[model samples]
Target: MNTILNFMKRNYKILVAILCLSVVFFAFNSNAKKDNDPERDKLLLELLTFVIEKGHYSPAAIDDAFSKGVYKDYIQALDPSKRFFLQSDIDEFSKYETRLDDDLLSKDLTFFNLTYDRLMLRMAEGKKVYKAILSKPFDYSIDENFNTDYDKAPYTATAAELKDRWRKQIKLSTLSSLTDRLKIQETKAKGTEETSEVKSDSLEMDLLDKAKSDKGVENSAPKTFEELEKETRVSAEKSLDEYFGFMNDLDKNDWFSVYINSITSRFDPHTNYFAPEEKERFDVSISGKLEGIGARLQKKNDYTEISDLISGGPAWRGKQLESGDLIMKVAQGNGEPVDVVGMRLDDVVKKIKGPKGSEVRLTVKKVDGTIKIISIIRDIVEIEETYAKSSVVEKNGFKYGVIYLPKFYIDFDDKGGRDAGKDIALEVERLKAANVDGIVLDVRDDGGGSLSTVVDIAGLFIQEGPIVQIKSAGRKKEVLYDRDKKIEWKGPLVIMVNSFSASASEILAAAIQDYKRGIIIGSKQTYGKGTVQNVIDLNQFVRNSAMGDMGALKTTTQKFYRINGGSTQLEGVRSDVVMPDRYAYLKMGERDVENAMPWDKIDAADYTIWNDNAKFKQAIANSKMRISQNDQFKLIEDNAKWIDSRSEDNTYSLNIDKFKTAQSSIEEKAKKYKPIYEYKNSLKFNSLPNEIDALNKDAILKEKRERWHESLAKDIYVEEALNVLDDLQSKAVTTKAMPVKIKKGKLAKS
Candidate 1:
């Protein structure tokens, strides 16, 4: 024993050395870099060890997949929406030294299998708990304590009759997603059907006859598919009102979407998920080739209301279509209309949308209480609407150049080609060539596109300076400056914007306003979304994998701001000239979204301001007089009231006496409008395109519009803006004011 102990002691130093060496070797083998992030590497190692021990094994055997494979798992865990971890995307992400996805990549099968299993188990448990709670009690206090009262005093969906309904409802919703692990397309139908059958039993026609009756589709009455559909839609829309609550139907496909979305959001607000349709439509929409009614429509529950009229579109051309009108029925030309009141918004849109020049008639319940057949010829609206259109407006005595910048235009297909900035430069050249005193840039509902175009547009007005700044994750903000000393159109500028102007539009408007280059007039604030999203087609990444192509994803990448920091997420841009709009009664603009990116001002950049804006103000004040007294402005205001009465919503009492009284009031207003031609063309929802022309008495219409535009020259807001521009040119001072508020900004743009 002594001899053995002596030998052991003698070799103890060597043995310890060997043990230390082994430890060092393993550490080196698993060492992640420390130049940027050391803590991340340590967590990754721990996760690797944890995963290898208990992760489920696939028949294919991913026990010791490559570190690259492991990395993918971590990425997916971080963003399970499958946003960044595309197979093709891996190649690009791999190029980065320390990918953000490293923490998300998984090293073993145990992690994936175990997590998936646990996830399913948890989901089942959740449903069980929800079912149990819902079955146990009924209370009216649910609205007050739903946020905190899941336990103890839960609200129940459980009357004997309600129990069966609750079960079915839970079955469809909770189980619809469970039938598949994720929200993926269940069937591709092999191929498209050459001819789809439309039954002569019109779903739309029957609903309309019912709607015009008393007690308009009550709760107990929602027995049919259509009725239930309407109720579901109504429920979905209810969340949109007051304070936005509840997850969107798309996000509720499965538990994973909810889980992944929350997890990744902790790291940064930009990253998010994309459903299959979101990905598909991402390309189709921007490409501008998708079959749509050529109008900007939005779903607000069972009601799909017109968000914006795609200017010069068939709906706009039909002239009867107005924002806030609810589409009730859809019919192909001369066919009986289908009441799509309770249908999915997208499905209804599909029903209404078709190939360009084809006719789709909408049974529109105008906000003013009139139900009319407004037929429109769906035409491919030109991209010009998304660009800057130049017009010469003489407000009061000053003839100012008016350029309507609909949105910050960008063509992604041309990213590798021509930049939209150059196009804007050309448009500016047109305005400059027109040489009409000062300029008024009207950007009412422009939502922004293309960073390069935004930068380029800003540069066109200013000689050159920092247009914007981008701050990457945990990195110092880098300024993107316009060093080019070229000015496309540097005349006194007046920028007209509404609550809907956002992103690139906000950047441009803010920059111009900040630089003292122009005045912004319109809404109280703009849609303050100053973030950027990158289109990620997951199919590109997983093309060779089992899923083939999952679809596309437009993931938020980063927030953009003026050279001086100010993210316009919840707070949109404020206008310089105020105008009254009927929509103001509703909660409008940003700051309405829950947890929208907060507004903060950063350090201001240095720039030179030309002190020559007095004349623009002088001209504006002078124009206001003409506008205030102008016959056209008076007529327009009167028409707004007259139109408002006709478009009155829900107040339509289906009572015979009320219906006739309302009809008489509508006819009276239509006659008193003073324009003889307005009455000649009766706007009915005709499915026939050839018949649409009769709605407008062309020559008289042109004469009236020209007269209207001439009157518009004297419009209080337009005239004031032009006068402001003239005053600026003459070196005048006009205090800024607000304009109309657009309500969509208050809710999730999803």
Candidate 2:
């Protein structure tokens, strides 16, 4: 004991010496940074110049990168109208140029707080400028007023400008003018006599004639503002009014600004920004009930168009609201009507979204050139609210287990029994206990839910392995391994998906494909949204700053990927067999969106492959042949063709005379198919008009779910998957089934 104590005392001195050296190093590193390190400050100043002077973006973008300890702002800053930022301000702002070496390394909250306060002031100023622009004049004119060399994002075209004219401003006339009279000016020392001012009247006219042809064969004539103004002013005024309301409303009404400000306060795009009211509205949107007229609205150009109407909702119940109506104005239950034309989309949404049981009148413009007022009494849209469903399908004379994963969803707002993953798992177990031949996990149209639950749900399929990889700014890689090795169902498995199968759904589908554990069947590709987002609360990033006093927002912080390098982008997982459905006509996918993060690859990690790699190609071939001959597929194809034809056109015009004939021609074709299911509308479960009365939420909640057991006979995708499973079950199957991969040539030609 004495010897050990002596040894410890001797080593303690060494430890103390090491600790003292570290402290000295840290202290010197923090304070010894040359206050006038022009090299560091020079780069900072240059970055500031590049961002403010050359970039077309928001100052918040610069601040976003700055907060993340990014010494360099790669993305430049632009005004709200997207005019290039002033370089002088960036150069002058060097007073706050910080090294961020030791303080950030030590995770000092003070450092973060100081940065936050500085950025908040900058961001506040940026917002102030934007507000002024929106308020001072409701400018939506682009031709004379819109600057051409700015960031031309759809939402960022805030200047009063002619719609979409910025796209044409890249011509040589706008960029530079060509002229030749160089030799006219000569030095005093050497005055050359080689140049004549011009030849004669004939020669000048000839030159001018050639010059007219030089402009281009297809010459474009710029619009005369006085001539165009008569028609454009109405639109311009409406746009100005809308933006004016939004800018004024933003002080307290539009919390979205606060949320975005809060998120960018912390880091570049890592944090989240959500308006306070929007957050509440988000809950109601997924919960399937809200006030105002029930309709899914989206901004298209300068108009707010109806996207979808929830069946049985107030809008649908009113029966006058159509899918493509333009909401020109909205009046609060008999109040003074306000024009909504050329308005910011969110502002329109704010006016449209309200509490249930309220009255909201829409001055809507129908597809047929007519305007009318539609009054709707809001109610809790029950069908839109619940995810309750039950399906019965029979396969191969024997009953196959039918399980539906309605969504990768969980009501985080609710406390007990709020787990969607667990609910799906329970359903699967119930189906398996029925002694069924096969199991189907229907993931069609599921956007996503909790990531933690996704990992848990993945464990229910293949034996333990890494399910996903999460990467952040610091290159921190979190491998979410499925340690739970419990196999839920060993029977033949099928996963049904569609174009809407997204994040969590893709993870499951990818896992199932990776392990050769199940057959994937659905649309040509899923939504391909495999990336993840992190919601950073604004107040947390700002430290002691009073940022907490602001509202919250969630930003798209980081992206997620599979254990393998490739992320799902334009192409989602190819299903084992494609299925024909109504949504096939819908032109929706991640590829259709702008400014979406692209698909990329990273370093590959080790993964264990299972032994089920036989005959997948042959299975795919067989399924394709059968689908080609199917009647349902032909109908779906025809509809998709019509839908595609409409989407390809940039402009649409309706001939009211021929329009009636065209509308009826299409409706007659749709009447060939009878309704698949009758609508059940009632408050009480028993009173609900339907054969699926026993399959109500109350019955499922009470654990009386055994009342129904169905098969997978009718579903095209499920049937194909079963056929593939049967082929796999066969020992006769030898070579790989013909790969069910998408041929770009086929898609391109189509």
Candidate 3:
């Protein structure tokens, strides 16, 4: 989701000069009485359009086609479920569809102003509709069905029709919850405490509790069907109330961001406008670190509640701050406490977060109803989930290392800070020290980050080579290379990817595949995001203006390609060994995106393939043969086909009996694939010595690692990856009967 570019240093002067020259004709008048600053909005529109037009890799013409695309996307984003806007409202909005291009050019806010005002009005009416619909109990005996295909569903013509639509929506939700609750009761009556459905429901409820901090139904005693049905209504009402509460918190600025994004995304799917707060969040996500107390807060009605704590955060270590606790006030150091109750969530967060080593004191009402003040020293909290983690597993008399990179993270401001490339190199060193026979680099769901990190990570497996090719608009392709001669991992290497793997992930996979340095496994192809984006801070362009923050823009500035000349754009790197995925047929990749950049090829980079991996071809053949004959894999393929067929099965019966029967049939059919989750391998995974030491100190960290290791034990794909690694081992090395030298416990240098 992030890309490498030091635009602040390299392109700042040019951008500012461009903005200064372009803004001479743009005149704005302030309206202090307006809800949103009209002058600021106009300036922002002017700045955004000029910046994108000049910087984008291939900017789309701001013509009628672009205007139409923006109109469709914006309207859909505003009311995706088609519950807020009426057909009459859409008819009125359609008048300006093609005229939006003129609005953008002249910085006219006519379309945006009309739509924003209308949406606010409609949303206010929608709040009334849903509340009234949920107020009355839905009759489950009615022989009716509801279609969840909101995209095709026509907007209601009148208030009466809208109410009926809302009723069906609410009824369907409550009916599903009612069925789940009734099933739990039935299972309890049957004395079946360990049913998979029960376990799944329990997990779902537990997750909801953590997310909402909602005190769920009181006691575990079995309830009558009537009581369960009422509970379902209460749950649905509470969920809708919370959703509307969040909607109420959004201001005109937030809506304006959406409107801006609708315009930006017309250039490409990845191009987006980030508000100031959103920009901060994007930075945290890319860096995987933040300067805060390390506790996540959510608005619960009028109170700000602690939802979760980062594992290694100051609040977590303090132990006084806990999830479900409500914050009443926040004070910086010994300053006077500010009442944060009923305040905006963003304002509350601003009050709570401070620079590292600063102290923030919070007055909180505990879950037990006792009030207490807890002072926490804010520090740099690294999100463990963002970093690459490895587990050493013993399989077939050899230790194989599995390293999972959640994303290609990097701290752009800090050159010495942790990045995917460096962390991966450290993991390789650790695995080598553990005497691992081979390594599996898992980037299954990695959406990618720093472009530089991809080169660094890919370089670890090869001695020296051109990693990837990059091409900007109207420019010659530039080849990025790994000039380093030291290969951190020269032994058996396998890179695991899925359809979610994208951008820098595709680059790494394609590079390794091109060099024949490692085998690429899993998914038919990756997420197919080949374009690179750079975040442009808009505040830098304006000088000393009272317009406040202008936020930032992330736009596609270049396209990346594999060393073999082909762009990974829509045709993401094809796997060397394809695996059956349940969601394989889902239209979730970049290729499915309507406005995605087209795929094209360039001249190949000059590089020699790694000739040392003699068993690579045989290993791939052996894996294919094993997977072809495996019953589990065959079942997985069948499940995939079943899932693809069921993708359109979005309608459900409203009658209680019919719903139960349909669900029961599904549960029975799902039982056939139960082996997928239950299957466990003989291999046992363990943490490295350093992680083991840290795990012993942190119970939360220990639990996370244990769960991950357990999941790895149940992963058939990982087991197959190990099988490939087994086949990939050099035969001559094994025949020599040479003992791997060990210095005490760690493996000696090869």
Candidate 4:
């Protein structure tokens, strides 16, 4: 979801120069003498404001307009559902709306203090309101409605009105759950097996044997409507209790982070502050590796529940820890087990996550009501989904390769480690080894990562050329070029993109399109994010600071443009062959943001458009004509329109009969589009020889590849991309150049 700048060497030098000047100024003035929470907070505000003002690519003027934007965004973020603060609280808070800019300039904390304390009070009151409403039986016969359009709904004026609002909301939830349970019971009574897709929490749990063993399977037997109704209320109450428990785990710093982000985001959607823990998570996300047991945990009231295990990690390989298992105690090797039942989830994670090769034992309560201890040797686990993977498919007696790059991943710490560029080159080499006729590089849902990787990847298809242009404020534009003259694959190439493809993804797609080296296919346009960001460590500016881990700031430092001199800021790359998308009617691109940067153009870079493919234009025309007459695609277009029409239907009834009737009508119409998910392209996707050998040894990897290949078989978009590749096939033998050296100076296709 972010782009890394290639000017790290220069960027850090610039930061050091500005930060030293700020440090000298801070030494002369002493506003908050004491080293307390408030003092550290004030220092953070000072450092954050100064860094962004000096470092941001296009720093917005900190005027009344900016203040108002922060005020609205912060208030909305605090109470997005409008279930906490009453109208009076908002009225009082609105007085300082335009004065936040002045307060920020003066380093004042009046507005933040007042709002944070008031939010705390309101949340305590909200806990009571929900508890009181769920304490008794709800009257399903009552004719009432609840609108989920919270943005447009007015806040309640009084406590009584707010209480009534809670009542109707809870009533609608219980009524819906009650009806689903009733249907399941009816199906059971008719000697028919109940469907696993029921909406009731307790009923859904019944499908798992673990639930039957722990909660008693007898509970799933046909129950009276009264019994089901009461259970619904209990389930609703338990969910609220768990939610409040999670909220209570958040200390003052967590809320302060939220408040800080509201201000930072006003400059741009991609710019924000990251706390210490959040920064660590961001690093893991981009690098796709972490040293731990590699299991995701969730806080369920008192116990830490194992949500899912990373496929190739220690826990997954151990084959002991399971999804429903609850960790009761954690202990280091040969150390006494420490109780983690009532501990915060973060604290539990801190206990479990350790250096690589360390041993940790966990005493877990199995779902079958048995207590057992399991030991695991922690190691560096690579998230398989984050890397690029390729699958080969046979179409019309020719082999085609499909490579899906989830993100442009890179390990900033270890330059020699795996990255998107290195992995993609290896995938291309593997596909070439398999004698593939064409290749489809799918970048769908890829939000983007390292900017340098885009250049390296785009270089694989073409000889030497500029891939993208980057511009800094008040500076000349710099064109990033691939100097390597060797091409790995000289076959038909197609780049697939959608609305979610952004930043680095856009840069790659735009370069390929401008070069005429590949045909762009998928959604009408991409996510329209053309900005570059650099994460600055705040601790580097402060000397002898008592505040532990000052965290980091990711800010927009530049904007990238296509080699054709066009900015993908607002108008992302338009697909050569457009496809229908379900969320097309929604405002989802960078242009949808209120304060997004405007689009502009620069001088085009000197590059030659590839003219080797003779049937490139004919392939595009053939695919467009085929899509126009396809029945499945027409049905997809109709479904997209139908989905858009239903976006505004947010209100639901509390009356049981009315609610059920309305839901039935919607479900009946939805059944007509069910075939969309079931549609298969009848293509067989397979792994290359190397991957097949690895998959045979690793069962987990085998299952993952099987699932991925199955998904590719059903993807109609991929089917079309393959069709385009088929049409682009040339009788003229392509001049396959020698493979160039990849990242880390290793020749992958030598």
Candidate 5:
């Protein structure tokens, strides 16, 4: 389910492009094939390949080289951990390594079929091996280690070797569970006067014997190693069961998606293919509103389990549906109940979600082992919970505003729909009414949304200017501009971004930096996704086709550049005040993505730099000095370095005693970093007076605001941003206002 969701998220721009592009009708074969048929898949492949070749901005040639790339990606996608397939399987599949392009061109599935069949066989073998390994108790006293870095590990060469690998994997999983349980027990036993004096070797035997007894075991003694082992085995079994169940649920379309993505991704990372169901999921994510029981569902051991309940949603209001509850069956109003056990999570969701005000019944098994039928009236679950929101932060008698934009979200189909720009403008107005001294625009972890919305938001800062330059293959560069001359906020501005901030986020930040409108702060660079994608409906491309709702194809149509000529492609927007972040040393950008478009530049768009640019140099210097002297900043740097070092150490001891000792040592070391979490800014944040009435009326809104304020008080990044804003504000007040001038040459420096 997570894999499918990730596929939708990465391919979201395709749905956006689908709405933006005018649907052009083309001739299609009337008698192609029915849905779910192999012929339909072949037709889909042909259509997808044709679309990529003709529509993609930088389509790779369909040659042996491309085929090899696809083959490697496809294999990796199939078994990324290199656990399911063996070296021999890879060797066998290598015959079609450079022949995939030929097969795709001919719409042949011979390679796909062979690989699929092999995967099924390997998975069955894996299930047997895991079950056989877990059937008996594991000896945690063995001195062995397991390397979790699967990329560096070689595939097993024999069945015995594969079983051994599975055994070690199972042991590692079980050891983690055992250690966690032991810690919990130790914590619980801390205040107790009586303590068990059971030896490590005899603990399992005693626990096994106690298990054979009655209720006296719980009250008479603490749990032994045998009980913990039993519990861990049960959990491991359930996990494996759920995994294989999910794997079994994958139809040809699922596998086809993997293959199609491999091909599309060769052109660029953003280009993708979305099945019809996947497109719906993308819409739900973007719209942030769905008519349903708003409970996050996950597949757990052949049952649809409620993982989380959205705050203020229907499920939350019901109070009966809780996390970890297993959904047994789903039924419509006054209808016969349909068992949902073993059903696909998407199918279960479809059964549960209905029109607003509609009733859906769910027979759920609670985590406490009680079963009940709970009926919930479905309402519009406002994913407004995921939208842009703001809070007023007060520091040193100055009230500053922090607006966190999760994405540049917009419903392209609905002009009057919720927009990030409008929401942000409203937030700015609310902050202005409260008389904020400055504002921090937080775009951290925002992967970006609508391009038009980003332009509108950028316009709110600057009076009027070109925001970004876009260029398609063999086409003249088109510069997107802020036509509106009205400035929404003239006070000091700070835009906060991180490694996850990409595309539209980069555009907004770059435009602000290019014009010296605001100080961009955070990690060294953003996600650096500069390309634009357009999702074209395959059905529209092939008119009157019997293939039945051919999924959309998202193709990279253009590449966007900052107004200052530099493309935010592999090289994302650089921050003015660089700070050490967890991802600072991590390879997590467009450059890290496979086949990401190379960075380049074009002529700078005609724009004038803000007259306040002179203040940035000194302000940046002051910020650097403060960060260098601050204890919190020092702790953050140390923590980031420690995390990076830990990330490099993938090998883990399998022995229970050694594993526990290692975990304890790490925990002891982690205690020193606890000060990082305890570090709190002196800033006091609050909701605007105008919003107080609304917030008071809406309990969920009030709760969200309180949570946001609490988080802001602890956020070191926002504190630093506020400090930057302070310096900018003070500089503005001390220095004389410079006359606005239009510079014709190079862009301003940060």
Candidate 6:
């Protein structure tokens, strides 16, 4: 009876396993059938639309108005310069401008198909028009003007009008070349006159006789106006050919990306759709590393041209590839070479990027027009060129460390990869070992990265406190705190920001300012980008749908606020010591972006103010006084005004003589600002002692460090920042400590 019981139990277990397998098999079959269904794209579209509507933080209602917005944005994106799609084409597309919402509901793409087909037709016509216009030399003597600001321009009404537009556009481009050539010739003539011996009257005749005896002129004649014009026309033709070739490489997926992004953009500028390949590119950019040939490729006249070789990458190490070399074909490990000419750049990049240690051979056309085949073994290229680096600057007998963090970079999937917080901590430790009096954290042009990393970095400068406040739609506000009680550096600290410093950069700068831990300096304000985004994998949303890799949707799911209850959306963090710079009057911040979220305030988080000294106001006043007296800064302010004036003048003269006169006038006026570029401070900058040996070992790295040091020696901003640091240090020695005050749950000064 016991043996009979054991047999029954074993059979029952087998039966359960069989049932489970059957269920999985049925589910797999169902998914497979769905994948083969013709309505897969429609289902995927529905899923995407639903996700955006349900998941976006500030989702816009998809009605007739929203559809109209999508239509206008999409059409503008396709032809932003107004170079394609005539009035007739726009009229044809306008018919469905209000019907897009209905089509989205039904999962139909009639509007997209119609607009895409018309764009293709117009693009084909544009290719021929530009080529025909560039085939012959342009008459630059015509007194015509081309307004570069496309918004004020109107669409062409007929083919003849479009052709005339193309002619003017091509003429404007050719005029630039003509002006450049003329300048070069004038420069050469000036050099010749400066070096040449005085020609005697008899010597001139003797030279002519000698030339006749030799049957040729001794020196090559300078290029004439007509010859220069022909050369300019040739160059313009080649450039246009490359431009049209790149346009031809745009496939359905490319146009679809633009279309889908237009839809996502209605929510916010930060929200975007990243196709599979685009996602990979985004990862590479953030991590600053990729496993590939390590060359930047660009489309040029039916060829994939190498634009740049990444320092220390496989191609750069190989020493055979170079910028301007055209990649004609690619082969894998002695396999048959596949012609990549006329292929899309992304597709060619895929063929070249492979697993590390794999061999790829490329047939390349060198810049000098020589063709050669070269093999390269792919490797992981680390773009350490833009990573955070620190240097010591000696000013007023005190050494100040300057840490330039280009971005807050982090690899999400690689646990062992580089982290900005950890790297910055290590840099701080190095600076401390050097016994620097103060530190200047430069986040100029840093577009920001990983939020967690910013919080970690901000924690280094202060004791435990709330770093930032995050609030999502329909969710409670959460305060991110630095739980750690240890401080990394307690010396005088200053953060330098600019209009390009954004997101994570603003977070650290704002937190440091709020806690009174450091003084902020540089531009009038930082880039206002307080939104948080997350890239969602679309495949995870579909259970049984057969759409292959529907890409990821980067949606802004939350908004961040300063610890002091202020949002950095439109009103970014204002610098305590504002300085005039090139972007001072430029519209280049979050306010410049379309569909940007409005700024608002939230409840301030609890925090403690640093109470080291109470001379912050005096320090800022001293800095301002110095800036007002400094001639370099005065020049900078004037230069900023000049740049703003130039940016406002968009109209250009097509006449060659007038164009040259304008160019010459600008160059002459710019001569006064030459001193700005030539100014050199007395400060001496050096790498940390521990890093000197490693830098010397790497030639490329050594050159980069040398260039960086040279730039620092000439940077007026760094000079001023060091002065501020010195002032802060001087005041700390004499000023008494003040009691920490809290106002409305925020750090306040008494």
Cα-based RMSD of candidate 6: 9.7
Tens digits of per-residue lDDT, candidate 2, 60-102, equal: 3334234333322212321333222234434433333453323
Q: What TM-score does structure 1 among the candidates reach?
A: 0.47
Which 10 consecutive positions of candidate 5 have the poorest summed lDDT?
Answer: 1-10
Return the candidate ranking by TM-score, descending.
3, 4, 5, 6, 2, 1
**Estimated TM-score for each candidate:** 0.47, 0.49, 0.94, 0.94, 0.89, 0.88
Task: Assess candidate 2 and give its TM-score to the true structure.
Answer: 0.49
Q: Which candidate gets the maximum lDDT versus the true structure?
A: 4
Q: Candidate 6's C-alpha lDDT?
A: 0.80
Model 5 steric clash pairs: none
Q: Which residue window of length 10 is worst by lDDT in model 4?
A: 741-750
Put down candidate 4 lDDT per residue, 1-750, tens digits, no spaces. Answer: 799976656766887698888886553224434222776777788888999998899999999999999999999998998888899999999999999999888888888889889988988999999988887888888788899899999999999998888888778777887787677777666766645434556534453334346666654555567877887888788878998899888877888888889899999998999988899889999999999999999999999999989888999999999998999999999899999998989889989999999999999999989999999999998999899999999999899999999999999899999899999999999999999999999999999999999999999999898899988887788889999999988789999999999999999999999888999999999999989999999988877455666799999999999887889998999999998877888789988988899999887777766757578889999999999998888888889899989998999999888999998888778878877888999899999998877898888789989999999989999999999999988766667444433322222443
Clashes (backbone N, CA, C under 3 Å), per candidate, total: 61, 37, 0, 0, 0, 0
Query: Residue 84 lDDT in model 3?
Result: 83
C-alpha local distance difference test of each model = 0.49, 0.50, 0.86, 0.87, 0.81, 0.80
lDDT by residue for model 5 (1-750), tens: 000111124234654365335334223457765544777777678777767776677888889999999998999899987778989998999999999989988888988888888888889988998888889999999899999998889989988888898899889988887776676567547866322321132333344444546555543456788978887787778778878888888877788788888888898888888887787777676667678988888887688889888877899888888898999989998899999998888788889989999999999999889999999999988786668888887787788999999877776667888878899999998889888999999999888777888888999998898988888787788877799999999888999999989888999999999888999999999988888876566775554556687778778877888887899998899999988785577677889877888999988877877776666888899998998898888888888888888988999999988998888889778878888878787778887787788787767678888888999999998999998887876632556455454344443433
Q: State in Å the error of residue 169, model 1.
A: 17
Clashing residue pairs, candidate 4?
Answer: none
lDDT (tens digit, per residue) of candidate 1 on 1-750:
000001122233543344334333232223433222233223333322222222111111222333334344344454342211224433534443232234334322233333444444434443344345333222211221111121222223223333333333333332212211111111212333411211112323244345546565432232343333343333323322311211222222333333334333332243444445454354443433345566777776567788777644577667788898998899998898998876766567678868877888899889888899988878766433344545554444555665566545444644543344665576567656655667777666776666666777788887777777664334456666788897877677778777677777787888887666777776567777766555444333221233222333334444566654666667766655545443443454556543245566555555554344445455555555655675554565576665565443423322333433554465556666455222221111111222136325444334433553454444455655655665665434456432222121221221
Once model 6 is optimally superposed onto the true structure by TM-score, how far is the C-alpha of residue 373 displaced, in angstroms?
5.4
